[model samples]
Target: MPIHYSIEIADAAAHLFAIELTIDTPDPKGQILELPVWIPGSYLIREFARNIVQIAAFSKQKTIPIEKLSKSSWRIAPTTGPLTIRYEVYAFDLSVRGAYLDQTRAFFNGTSVFLAAKGFETLPCSVQIKADSFSAMSKQWQVATGLCAAAVNDNGFGHYTAQNYDELIDCPVEISDFSKIEFEACGVPHQMVISGRHHADMERLAHDLRLICEYQIRLFGEPAPFNRYVFMTMAVGDGYGGLEHRNSTALICKRTDLPEIGSEQQSDGYRQFLGLCSHEYFHSWNVKRIKPAAYAPYDLQQENYSRLLWAFEGITSYYDDLSLLRCGLITFEQYLHLLAQTATAVERGYGRKRQSLEESSFDTWVKYYRQDENTPNEVVSYYTKGALVALCLDLHIRAETQNQKSLDDVMRALWNQFGRHFDTLGQGIKEHEWETIAQAVTGLDLTAFFDMALRSTTDLPLSNLLEKIGVQSQLRLASNPTDKGGWQDNPVPSACTWGVRTADDPQGVKLTHVLRHGAACAAGLAAGDVVIAINGLKASASQFASLASNAKSGQCYQVHAFRRDELMQFELVARDAIADTWGFCKSKDSCQVNKEMLATFLRN
Candidate 1:
């Protein structure tokens, strides 16, 4: 007999909604029920089960009391025959990861559903959802799941079955006014269901997505791994982000984020939106399938630590925008400009001060996702610097092998060894396993690269890497005044600076490390010194830039500062700003090397 489960969503009132689940099964001794501690793609340990308010269970019309087994699992007493279980999940928050209920709508992630069975953890189960009639106002309520035998009902409910927990967690369902657009990319059926107020040029978006898929396939020299793909978008107000999955992705974005075609400024926004799309799309290979061992069989209850996020997220980030360029969606200049912006942002943050890339990856839960004012001063972004690291490593590989091998080789080797070969039973790729793969692919030791580049804060030779790819990394000083009227400066010499990087704390303008003898440092200021005033005016992070803009070379003024809780004053002198620092250079040789390495790398 088929194991059966059902869900019903009822509109109780505005600011409140009700969800009910019913399940039927015969065996109880071997049954195990659990709620996922975290969702994939988003690497944080959030106990979603804590949100459950009231629960009840019944067997053969007799009431059964449920017992808590663990933080995320529960147990039901032994039953003689077929058992029926029911419960209600609370929905009160409106965030992307949480369940939210309101007068207008209700959103939930599947882990909220309670299960009861004998060895339920191992038993194959089926779910049938019963939607309220009012749900018809949504136009259509669709389910995005990996479960088998799924069907939709006229009452707005859908039915699906999961072979196991892995399949169950992979699927996410949405009930709303969703527009479903289907097309084929690289011979794979691709579907996009956009909900919540999507007003962009759907046709153009669809065409662009098709091209993106084709480009990715060409990169790997094969069709995508999934037979079908889904892009499910949840639109709220002003939010923008997404999480990737094996066969589908969930996107949370603002309706206004979609840009109109044929408009100049809107084109930039469109490119950004597409960049997000490409980022998640590339995950189909780089992350979703070819995952690090730590993430292979994810532990939802706590952090899954890995140092290779730079490889997973950073490399994917580099390609997200590059995919746009390769598909002729963006210009080379635009690509470089985007890189420059990313580089400058990476150079300005204080996060780099407290965390290295590997540490940043390992501590993403505490540092990256949870950001504060000191973030700029204390934490480095794995996404930004991680991409740069990928570029550096790719160039290093190319330069060492005379353009015969590159980072792409590492990616394909991963796909072949871990992704294609591994089954659900073998879910992760170990750290040393990646090292072994890299050594085999490149015929060289990657220990130094992993140690120095991935683990250590050794300055990346970005210019050399860019030059190898026929791109110049240009770093120019700002001679022009910023809107705030400060001589835009970086804290490091030959570094790009915007004059002020501030923390939200009232530690009162501590001069965090002035870039190796920058304007602030050259004027005899050291890091850890708090600026009390700029040119005799009380200053904040925002105000310092304005003061710097109005000043000229050889301008001297009394600068008050506090260091180690002691107030001190110094005479500061400003110097004329330098215009450009040639950061990277590339010739025909480097370009050819880059192309050849890329080709070989993708070919495995």
Candidate 2:
């Protein structure tokens, strides 16, 4: 018999979910059950079993003995008939990676609520969502998920079926009095459900999203992968995140990020939100289907390591913003501004000179996810640098073949060869096999390029490659701490540097980081130091930028700070700012050939 589960709100006010699991044909050798330590798409091992507050087992209405095998596994004694287990999970997490519940709404990922029954994981399963268990005042709430509805009420609270345990947990469930808008893209139904208080223009959201979705669908050719898709969002005062699923995605964003009624101009926050959506949607084929060997069959109990995250995540990052430009959602000048900002961010960090992209991808579990104050000095991000690598590859292919082939061709080949047959073949790209595949697709031997881009710590040659696409690259020192690099005809330079980032504090200003080879490091100033006075005057976070910009070079100042409640004093000398900021602009002298290549690159 198939496995079955039923879930309901045990205590809405207390933030608990009651879940019951039943197996009709239990394994005679003591059935085993386990909860996943981490969810896919997120590399961290969160140990979700720690949230189970209470549990028990029964057989034929008789109490059955249960023994703990490990932190996430349990074994029930052999029984003559059907076996059942009931438990209460404390769901208090408010992020996109776990379960959350309260009077406002309820959300959960099956990895945090359902337990996988050993020896029967491949069997089909059914889940019953008891929406009636919610408080009387919340009876109007509706359920939204990617699961196939087997038998459900008008409110979408009833039975759902899954092909196997993997598909069961891949879709997240969101229940609330949400505002929903539905639209069609490429002959497939799509819906976005939002939960929170906001005065958003739902029509504008649907129009812009339809453009992005249709562009991506047409990019990989027709016949979309999924029949339908859902965008489950939770808007709060301030937040930002997204996790991709096979046919849906869970998102969290600041309420202000939503587009306001009667507002036509796009804000930076809104652009960022759109980029997040594009990034996750592209994963529908790049990661969720065309996956790395290590992730083909995820080992949820422990860490899964792969060095090709640069291709999976970084390539997706590169296309997220580019797709926006191609879809006419943003202007060409604004796209260049975004590119310059990314370049400045990657160049400003000193860590890129120390860690290779492969190492960063391999150590994501320990370093990337769990960052520290010294993260900038030791580790680099595979996401930012990986985008640059993809950019270089695309440019190189276009210049070498005179715009005859590009990364777009390579992606289409990947989809046709691997992604189209993933469900049946269940095969993944090997660890060191990407270079070979790219070469075969483009007919170019990229051994030297791959070695420098993936195995070395040196920065990629971006200036030359950008020129081939009719773009000019410029690098200069930041005008101030808040100067995010972009194209400027006449830019003012800062007088000096403090080499420290400060936040508002009750005392005065709290140092958040001390950059290497900066004035703060030279003066022995470290993170967590609260600066009360500078040059015998009061120091504040509001005025710190002006003081740093106007201070004369080679000037000495007396700094007084408190390190963990101890008063201290030091002499700091103002130093010149480092020239690491980047700016990009259209080249006036670009020939017709270069302009044509640029148009070809950005065309939908």
Best candidate, lDDT-wise? 2
Q: Write the per-residue lDDT of candidate 1 for residues 313-394, one digit (tens) a residue.
A: 9999988887887787886667666766677667655456557888988888887887654466677888988888777777
lDDT of each: 0.66, 0.90
User: Please, what is the TM-score per model?
Assistant: 0.81, 0.98
Overall local distance difference test of candidate 2? 0.90
Q: List ranges where model 2 is wrong by over 4 Å.
A: 135-137
| Tens digit per residue, CA lDDT, model 2, 379-445 | 8888888888999999999988889999999999989988988978888899887788889988998
> Which 10-residue span in candidate 2 carries the lowest summed lDDT?
131-140
332 Cα displacement, candidate 2 (Å): 1.1
RMSD of each: 5.5, 1.3
What is model 1's C-alpha RMSD?
5.5
Q: Give the TM-score of candidate 2.
A: 0.98
Where model 1 places Cα greater than 4 Å from the true spot, the runs are: 1-3, 12-32, 101-106, 112-118, 133-149, 153-156, 261-266, 424-427, 478-544, 552-604
